[model samples]
Target: MARLLALLGSINIGGNRVKMADLKAAFADEGFGDVQTVAASGNAILSDDREPVFIETQLERILADRFGFKSCVMVRTRDEVARAVADNPFHGEGPQHGSDKMVHSIFLSQQPQQSAFDDLLELHKSKGSERLALGTRVLYLDYVYRVGVSDLSNKFLERKLGVKGTARNMNSLKNILSKMDAE
Candidate 1:
């Protein structure tokens, strides 16, 4: 079975607190092999040969049934994640971007259209100092400042893009990718 990463949304935040151990157990109970939770932020790596789409739906159901909250799970293959990292334009390659904590990859549920991306930028130009770039089922975000003070949010992004997604900082993503490769 191939190992994959599940980037879960709305986890450990906004009153949807989920213990990492319980989250792992939920996946294991659902028959996902080598279930492991990372960063306590709902990133899970598990071995399964099933399609990502099927796994996503199944995980969403599991979260609702086990934790009483709905979530969007973005399952990505190892290569897909590596590509996401490399595709990121603001990966601390220069002084123009913020630190790794400010750089994030929003794992989108579906590929957004070019027009949607344009509209998203147009709507967000005055909102903050963040920079955005569209990628393969991913939205690259660079918060020029602290995330806590930012006005941008998951709800706003979902509403503008019309798709569900989960955001992870570059540091967390790299740590998860390292663990994923070690196994």
Candidate 2:
């Protein structure tokens, strides 16, 4: 079995909530092994013999059928996680000024189109936010306002691009990566 990390979209946010235990059981029912949840926010680590893409497709279908909502999930191998963290575009930059909880990263299903980057930058500019960086498959955002007050929600991007994605704080990301590494 190969170790894989799945960045699941909201399973417990808003009115739609899925129990972690039920989610894990679903994966096992679908033939996955060693299924583990990293956080309550829907990050999962598991071992599966199936191809990542196939597993993702299956999970999406199951989630939609069972939970009555559809969200994008990105699956990556252990090596991909390491590389993604190392490749973070905002490697050395401090958070934007006057911001409480500024750092944000968007996990994409694939490398976004150039037009997507252009659009994201334009959006940030219009909002008077200064710092924005796009990496291989992640977009980092720095905000000047408190994160709760900022309009940079994952739902906004998902609607803008007509795709599904989930956002994670930098600390959560690092912890997930570290756990995967230690495994």
Relative to the unseen true structure, what is the Cα RMSD of model 2?
Answer: 2.7
**Candidate 2 whole-model C-alpha lDDT, 0 to 1:** 0.74
Worst 10 residues of 1 by lDDT: 92-101
Candidate 2, residues 1-183: lDDT per residue as tens digits? 899988888768886688889888887787788888887888889888778888889888878987788867888888877665566555445455422245667777767777877787787777765466777677766554456777767777666655666777666777888888777
Candidate 1: clashing residue pairs, number? 0
Tell me the alpha-carbon RMSD of every candidate. 1.7, 2.7
> Each model's TM-score, in the order given?
0.94, 0.85
- Predicted candidate 1 versus true structure: per-residue lDDT over 1-183, tens digit per residue: 999999999898888999999999989999999998898889999999999999999999999999999999999999999988889998884234545888889999999888988998998888788889999999998876767887778788888888888998888989999999999
> Largest lDDT belongs to which candidate?
1
Residue 33 error for model 1, in Å?
Answer: 0.3
Clashing pairs in 2: none
What is each predicted model's overall lDDT from 0 to 1? 0.90, 0.74
> Looking at candidate 1, what is the lDDT of residue 101?
81
